[model samples]
Target: MTSAGSTGWNVVQLADIPATPWRNGGGVTRELAMWPDAGDWAWRMSVADVDKSGPFSKFDGIDRWFTVLEGAGVQLDVAGVLHRVTAGDAPLFFDGAADTGCELIDGKTRDFNLMVRRGSQPSKMVRVEGRHSETLNAMKTIAVYAHHSPARVLFDEEVLQLAHATLAWRMVTGSAAVGIAAQGALWMEIPA
Candidate 1:
């Protein structure tokens, strides 16, 4: 894990992280990052491969955002409300404590997830396509996940080459614009 006080940024390859099976035995997930690095976490980011249809893990007092990255996607039944989440769809946000279960739309699907502890850490995910630049002001941390290979990210004077499914993290304060070049990516901003 990279410290928040690190000099610049940390780039992580998806393949480098070990996969852990979901408690419900419905899928496998690779946790990308977590705050505090130990004990209870305020926020967590991960990617999961949903191979079966079943109930999702329950997390009381947590808000979750799910985005389909590959395959057809999944149909989420959140407290009786159904949501069709596909690769191109905006991330679906729901209560982690809700009675939630999912059905694979076509087959196995890969999805990205962001879980934030309610009231303590409010987070947002934005989809980025092609070339884009954004200024970070009110964020304590910013993470960029490249859905398309060979993604180029420019922060300050540093350049990072991210492979498909790879991610980069930066802890920021004040204001600065980050440049991204990719076919598709997910930008997650965590409030300080």
Candidate 2:
């Protein structure tokens, strides 16, 4: 966050959010944000701690994206097919309504999750390391989350320093050039 241009931001440290137990009893979750700020949000984001192997809650007509933020990894079962996901891997995208289950690779895992209701909210996310520089436009939100390492962003001549396990997002108003330096971080964009 910075007083730059027409956009404003909210920077959140994940540790500050209260953890809510998952209905499956497999773990807990700390919800980060939801679009519309009201009932029936189009998109949702959160950090989930998977402590054991179990089934995942279903969400019909929703697209799910998952990325490992900490710990070893997990094998996600989607419709009987197994996909191994780790911190170094790209986010896995699958149908939220699919028969999904998780098996831990070793111990518990901390993960980043984004669920977008089909047709209501479209999004794209990428795991970033090193450096990234680009011009972004026509977006409702642009967010960066530093998972296990600190990161930095430069926007509108303003610099935002993101500590470990911090999520910083801005209400994107117009096109702007952004520069980011991070390791094992998640970068996301949601169209306006």
Instruction: Find the candidate with the highest lDDT and give its number.
Output: 2
Looking at candidate 2, the ten consecutive residues that score lowest on lDDT are 1-10
Q: Model 2: per-residue lDDT, tens digit, 1-192?
A: 122333366787887888999886889999887777638887788999999999999999988899998889999999999999998899998999999989999999999998888775577788889888779767667888888689998887888888998888887788899888997688887766
- C-alpha-based local distance difference test score of model 1: 0.84
Output the lDDT of residue 17, model 2. Answer: 84
Tens digits of per-residue lDDT, candidate 1, 102-159, equal: 9998999999999888886578887787887877776588888997556888876767
Q: Which portions of model 1 miss their true places by more than 4 Å?
A: 1-7
TM-scores for all candidates? 0.91, 0.91
